[model samples]
Target: MSVDEIIEYLRTLPKGTVVRVLVMDKASGHLWSSIVENVVDGDVWCREDVGTLIEDKDKKPTPENIDRVLAAVPGGLSAFGDWLTQEGWDILRDIYDDAIDALR
Candidate 1:
C-alpha cells in the first residue's frame, strides 16, 4: 500500500499500541538491523530512515524487517487482539495484511 494508506491505517489505531517497522543493514560486511517505531502517540508517529538498509549513517528499519518480526512474533493474530484488550489500542488489521502483501 501507499505511504498515505499505511499512515491512515496507523492513525485509526485505538491508542498506545506498539507498532514498529524493522529493516536490515548490509554494512561492515555483515547484516545489521534497526527499527522504525510508531506508537499510538495519541494518533501515529512515523519516521523512515534512509541508509539504514544500505548503510548505518541514519538507520531505520525496512518493510522486510517488519515482516520478519511479524513472522516471529508469536500469536500474531492474538497479538493484535491482545493489544486491543490490554492496551485499548485499536488495531488496523488490514494494514498488517497489506504490509505482508507489500513485502511479499
Candidate 2:
C-alpha cells in the first residue's frame, strides 16, 4: 500500500492499539538476518533479539559490508532525544505531513 493508505488505515485503529511496523533494509536479496535494536521511548517496541542467525554466523563482511549499508538505506531517525535526519528528510516530512507535527 501507499504511504497515504498506511496513514489513513492507522487513524481508524483505536488508541493504544498494538501495531507492528517493519522497516527492511534490503528490497531484494538472499534470505537473511536478524534485527537487534535498543532504546524504548514509548509503549511501542520490539522483542529483544540478541541471538544470531545461522546464515549470518561467521559471515561478517567488513569494509564492503559497511559500504553496502550506506548505499541501500540513506535515511534514518533517532528518537532518543529528538527528531533528526541523515538525509532525504523531506521525503518523510512530506509523507507524514501534519500527522507527525503533533508528535513534537
Top lDDT model: 1
lDDT comparing candidate 1 with the true structure: 0.51
Q: Model 2: number of clashes?
A: 0
Best by TM-score: 2
Off-target runs (Cα >4 Å) in candidate 2 are 26-104
Clashes of 1: 4
Model 2 lDDT on a 0 to 1 scale: 0.46
lDDT of 1 by residue, 1-104 (tens): 66688889989998877766543333522224434455433332122322243235443466665455446647874685566565542345544667867884
Please give each candidate's TM-score: 0.26, 0.28
| Number of colliding residue pairs in each model | 4, 0
Where does candidate 1 clash, by residue pair?
Answer: 14-90, 22-62, 23-61, 23-62
lDDT of all predictions: 0.51, 0.46
